[model samples]
Target: MAEGLRTAYQLEEDDIATILPEEEDKFNGEEFNKQFLQFDRDRIQKINQKGKEKFEQGYSKAKKEVLDQLETEARERFGVEDDELRGIDLIDHIVEINSKKSKADPTKLTEEQIKSHPSVIKLLNEKEKSFKTREEELKTEYDTKLNNFQKERTFSAVEKKALAIFDKMNPVLSSDPERAANQKSILINDLKGLDYQEDGDTYIPLQEGKRLEDPHGNGVSFEKLVQSRAARYFDFKKAEERDTPPAGGGDGGATGFPKTEAEYAKIVNDQNIPLEERLEIKKKWNEAKSQS
Candidate 1:
């Protein structure tokens, strides 16, 4: 019976072997598992190293390209040489002098010693003076250019408002040649309302005075309305005079008459002016035309 049992077990082993390859002689299951884990860790480390190397290479290339482009642009746009653009070499000289001083005996730094190191002192002084000179030059250039730009293109809101008021008064004033001529000085005097005491050039509207409460209850100056009207008239007259060039280069010139009586009638009909003043201006205009 024991012999029969051994034969049956051997036959079963043979059948299993025939169905599958024999277990690998070198396969220690636990050792193989540990080896697989170490293989994975090594692969991960290699991948990280490659990634870091690529990142470093890209960064270095970008930095070099950017620096080269900046240098090229500076040279092209500003005519700055590489040496000049690198900044003054005085700093290197200063560092050298400071280093030497650090090594020298502090107690022995006499006037003679300082004078002997004249090159360092001269370089320091030259650097300071050159910096100051360059700063002053830049400031002056900026101010000059800014002023020219302002003069050519800038206008304050007050100036624009004043000009608009002047335009509105133009036709009325131009209608009466005699009144425009005779009262021109008075009209100029009336412009005092437009003149703010601040910078003395700006003109705010007369309505702005309503905002201020006077302690004496004096209220808004009644003169403001008269002044504004007169100022507008005067500005128009001045513009017209400028447009009408002097004949024969002298103050005495022919007064150009209005083309028609209807033109003068328009000023006589404007409602903004006092009825009495409008009528008076019209009468004077008629008299001037009759004399002409």
Candidate 2:
């Protein structure tokens, strides 16, 4: 009998365990197959309908929440009213309704309704103006305090200029001790005739040729003394050069530097080459000049 059943059904050994008599009833005929297919279709349709309904409900709730938040914010910030809010035409009503409420008529608006109505926008502008005015007042008060502080701690013109010179020189002095020393020597030689005073630790520049008695006045050389001060000024200039090195044209020939007459002038001026060399440079300048 088993051999006959196997021959008729063409079932394998694995299939035999799952093919129960009751289970076989559903697949035995075309009518049962049709009924099973219809049941599956009905189940799928029901599930889809339920999912769509839930999605629509959630979307509506979210939209309402967003609108509520926008309305609250607008009212607080700009004093916008409900009557001022008009529904935008071209924009999605859901998104527009969710946006900040403005003082405009929703019903009468045509294509592309203004996000914020004129009245609502004007109110917001007024609020911004008030904030800016307050900020300016605070700033003025702070500036006044700063000015008073500066006046209380003031330096003489010569002292101030000396400090400025020292600041300029400091960077150079820090970078190359040798170059700074050389510059200091040259400056002292140049300013030999100037009279200077020491305020605290700093030497202040004074009127030229005004001799003040030095405590160690054993025939002090005025030229040597002024030269020492000049060195500081020269060192500062050198330091500036070191800090901002020539851009481009390194050993690799990058050519990133500007190629123009104006740019050339800037480079030459910065290098501090002697006047004779500068004159010679102008002779060959056009030929060697880079095109802009």
Candidate 3:
């Protein structure tokens, strides 16, 4: 119940467990709580009220269904309309919405039948327009940002000297666009922080401290951080690629895909993997549904 309530209200269970109890014991209830801790009387009252309600309701089926849906949406973690999985649910959603009409129609409805339905077709067309508009927005924004960054000459010295060292050190970063961007950003920051001497067409890099902040803000060597994280991103990107199915639907062959929707749901709900990565896996999962 404690964990469930924490999740339902987006409370930090670890924060409460580690910090709240200690603070409670350390101070008297009559004394004012510290503002930084964010554990004021009203907050605690709200949590207690919700807990009382949940306890009285006893996790009813209606509440369970709502919670399940909220949990699923949270897991979906849908980002901007990437072209790859562009509105895969439009067909399913439309079919569900027009189930009665579909049943009464003489024509046998195929999985792709939504393509022919007037309403479905219209919605899809509009979504495509939206996709294009969003794409253009992204492109214009990216170009503007890139131009500004270039004009600033923020990384010119890094590009001159340490870029070669960075390339030699973090080659795995080149495999994916996101990884490449992250590596570039980190290396530029790392190099800029370093003390450098100007030479002919090159730079001599030095710094008093031997360590630069890792991308995660912990201390580590730039080479070490890039080597470790680059390898991880490479593996993750490769797995993402291998998992993506061809848009023509699942291949007319077996490929170790999840055999049932239940299995797919289990995988999709997995909180261990990154949410975006899990969503990509859900996109590629076979459409098989479990008997249960």
Candidate 4:
């Protein structure tokens, strides 16, 4: 029975072997599984590397196509072409060409050509306008300087004439330089309100508005006005009176009582007399006159 059982199991094994092919003795199932997994990994890695290379090539081609399109558009629009220049460089070149054309000489062109070039006409018009403006400015400057010079000359002439009138009116002023200067200044100020009439090449001082008359009811001359006004402001005496010695003082020219009109005049005209003594002398003169 054991022998028969062994034979039956062998037959079953033979039948299984026929259905499933047996591997060679050197083939290991575990090792073959490992090798198959490694091969799949290497294949996937190669596919990924090929895909990356294709993507890089596509990107480079797209970038070159875009740059070429831009250059074509720029050249067509600007009417300029250069293989070495692209984008902004092409634009700058076009601007330089147009600038040169704008600056072209109108003198070398025909009338019709010059009229057609409006930029040249505009530049010439602007230059002409600038020249006219400069001319107007120079004229204005010259007129202003001439006006100022005329004003100065007129003022100097007026002052010189005023000083001469003042000197003639007051002989005291001629000897005293400081007093002469002061009186001339005052006379000039008074004359500032007067009008001036053109007299030959010079001007004559004429009174304006309300005219002033002297005590004799006659129109006052400039000289008479200066003399009267000076007398009003200053106490002027004859030069001889100022130099003469006082009388009746025991040979010392000291002030004393006055007996006559000349003695009284001398005492009063003497500036060296004390104010109190002068007052006393005046009181004595009044008393003597009353008693008579």
Candidate 5:
């Protein structure tokens, strides 16, 4: 033995047994290779099987979803509600119905068949309700307008005739352009106060809801009636005074107060004299005449 090295003779039995192996205990290369190869094969097989199962499951689910989508689209396009018919059979039924509709003549359909159609019924209902109502409204509107227009025309014709009569009643209006319109307006208002209204092309004067008549029981012309009432309304000249002196010309003298009937006429008829001053002269002349 080398120095400091323990020999077999000097070591304990337990220590020697611990360091050495028995003859029956040893490694085997062939058995290890067989077990490792089997383990690898089993693992690979399990992974492949699991992948196949996942693929099958996914394929079936996707296929079912596609089929369901196709059925929904087909039903909407063909407006089909037959739950029993599906896929190609449903498509064929939709095509056959379309073909029948295309081949049928719309004009040959009976009234009941036409009424049963949804779109046709909807259109007919709308027209029946709206067209008649709209036509009535338009007719009423047209009638009202026509009535108003006729009334306006009659009124205008009567006014024109009345104005012509009034012009004859006050001939001075033709010469006095400035006061003619105002005076005519006043006269027309007075005529209206006598219950004047238009009857066709003529003017009617009503008294107590009856047409005014002359003593002869004849219908009194508006001209004659207005002429009879003219004196009460105004002291206007029916015709220019025969050779009367011009206004403000020695008619009233220095005081401008008329002393005689002729002087009063000249003063009142004078357009040159202001209306207020003429009215005042008339009032004073009347007072003086009453006292006399």
Candidate 6:
């Protein structure tokens, strides 16, 4: 009976194997599998998105700390913001006023100069051109501000000790404020990345780059030690502006753009120009006329 049962089971398996793949009565297995894979993929995608958001939030906070300081400096020292004053024209006005009045520093500005500066008056007169030009400069400044991706881990004890050691190794760095700042920046990056071992009275670094293996070690991570050196994204944007020829090509020439209202009027009325280019010129002329 057992042998007969075994033979019957074997024959059933053989019959199942003999059945055509197309005829198999699968319980929506292909659909279920596809859905299962897609579900996990969607979850992973969401997780990645969340991670990016978290990183951006942290970075933004750090950058805001840096920016708030600059804004405070601008507001308290410069007195720049008002109803009419805005953008680089305002800054230029401030700078010019500061330059004329102050003895020590030339950048400290006051609110009164916003209206009085010759450059400021000129900017207000040519608002459109100045607005467009300064807007481009602002874009360049914003692009350069894209740094601080992964911030350094700094401890007071480490910094104090590092500074002591750093001054001994390089004593001539702090002759001027700018050189001192650059020196400090370079030293802090190097000191933070070192893993140290004590020898009686002195601290000695294990290596230049690697952190100590022990969990209890007093070493900063290699990444935390160095300042990020990312290249400016879209640096070519401002460079492109510098590379651009002056309006109507350096020397006096036909810029293919009508400079005067009379020129625009003549070009728009002329039938010799192509219909598309003429239409463009007419539309531009009408817009310029309205603005004027």
Model 5, backbone clash pairs (residues 3+ apart or across chains), number: 0
What is the alpha-carbon lDDT of model 5 when measured against the actual structure? 0.56
lDDT for each residue of candidate 6 in 99-169, tens digit (9 for 90 to 100): 76656344444657556666556444555454455556555544444321111212333555555444333
TM-score of each: 0.26, 0.22, 0.23, 0.33, 0.34, 0.22
Clashes of each: 0, 12, 0, 0, 0, 0
Question: Taking the tens digit of each residue's C-alpha lDDT, what string does model 1 give over 1-292?
Answer: 1232235222244433433233333334476446544543564476557755765565555555544554454345434444454322433333345546579654456556554565545544654565556556655655675555343222233333443444355433544545644554454344433333223444323334443224665533423443445555444344545323234421211132234677445645544344444545555565766887
Off by over 4 Å in 2: 1-27, 79-116, 119-292
lDDT of each: 0.44, 0.44, 0.46, 0.53, 0.56, 0.46
Query: What does the lDDT read for residue 180 in candidate 2?
Result: 44
Tens-place lDDT per residue, model 4, 177-204, is 4554565566567656665544564464
- Backbone clash pairs for candidate 4 read none
Point to the candidate with the largest lDDT: 5
How much is the lDDT of residue 180 in candidate 4? 48
- Regions of model 4 farther than 4 Å from truth: 1-109, 171-176, 189-197, 201-292
Q: Which stretches of candidate 6 lie over 4 Å from their true place?
A: 1-34, 53-65, 79-90, 102-292
Root-mean-square deviation per candidate = 39.4, 36.4, 31.6, 53.8, 52.7, 38.3
Model 4 earns a TM-score of 0.33
C-alpha lDDT of candidate 1 relative to the true structure: 0.44
**Pairs in steric clash, model 1:** none
Local accuracy of candidate 2 as per-residue lDDT tens digits, 160-250: 3443454443434432445644654454345534445555655544454444445774434433444456564543344324433244432
